[model samples]
Target: MHIEQLKQKIVAALEDLKAQDLTILDVKAATSVTDYMIIASGTSSRQVMALARNVQSTAKELDVELLGMEGLDAGEWVLVDLGDILVHLMQPQIRELYDLEKLWGEFANPINHQA
Candidate 1:
């Protein structure tokens, strides 16, 4: 699938599960690992795990390769690695503590997903 389509599918998967504070960071210039980093928060550990699962399912449905996943056991944070994109699902407190937006702030452009 195209990158944009893959992104949309991933975002929709998160939104379907009511993921909060969805932020898409264009990190093409900052990192070589992935072109985009999607960050979102879940209200609780269960929600975080659910969101990650949904994203994984969506990627599978779209035939996107799932490179890796992490932090699912603890559910404090979950990282879904697609070849060109990385999805981060975390509880609100963990999200606030890590401050990924700020970490990538300098080089990442926050894409406005608003209509």
Candidate 2:
């Protein structure tokens, strides 16, 4: 699928599970690994894991290549690698602590999805 369509699918998956504070960061200039980084907060570890699973399922349905996944065991945070896109699912505290937006602020074109 096209990157933008894949992005929209990922966003929809997260939204379906009520992911909070969804933010899409354009990190093409900031990183060589991926073009976009999608960050979202889940109410708890369980929710975080669920969000990750939903993303995975959606990607699979779209036949998008899955590069890798991390932090699923801990469930404090989970990262889904989709070649050109990275999805970060975390608890609110973890999200706050990491502060990815600020870290990538220089090159990031942040798009906030409010719902």
Candidate 3:
């Protein structure tokens, strides 16, 4: 699937499930690991995990396979790798420390978005 398409799908799933501070970063020009990075926060651990799982399942329905999932135990943050779309579902604390938005803020050049 296209990176842009996957990014939109993940964003929609998170928004429908009420994830907050939705941020999508296009890293295709920056890194080879992935084409995009989706960072969002959920109020609690359960919510964060749920958002990750929902995203995973939805992507599957669309045939977007995950490379792997991490941080399902304490669930502070769940990283879902969708080849071109890397999702970061985090609680406030985890999100703060990682500061993904800050890291990508300077590089998030607005591009065509379907979502």
Best by TM-score: 1
How many pairs collide in each candidate, listed in order?
A: 0, 0, 0
Best by lDDT: 1
Residue pairs clashing in model 1 are none
lDDT, model 1, position 110: 98
Report the lDDT tens digits of candidate 3 across residue range 1-115.
7766667777889988999888778777777888778888999999998998899898888997778999977789999988888889999998999898788768664344343
- Model 2 agreement with the true structure over 12-110: per-residue lDDT tens digits: 999999999999999888779999999999999999999999999999999998989999999999999999999999999999998998999888889
> Each model's TM-score?
0.97, 0.96, 0.88
Q: What's the lDDT for candidate 1?
A: 0.93
Which one wins by TM-score: 1 or 3?
Answer: 1
Q: Local distance difference test, per candidate?
A: 0.93, 0.93, 0.83
CA RMSD of each candidate after superposition:
1.0, 0.9, 2.2
Weakest ten-residue segment in model 2 by summed lDDT: 106-115
Q: Tell how far residue 68 is off in model 1, in angstroms.
A: 0.4
Model 3 residue 4 distance off true place after TM-score fit, in angstroms: 2.2
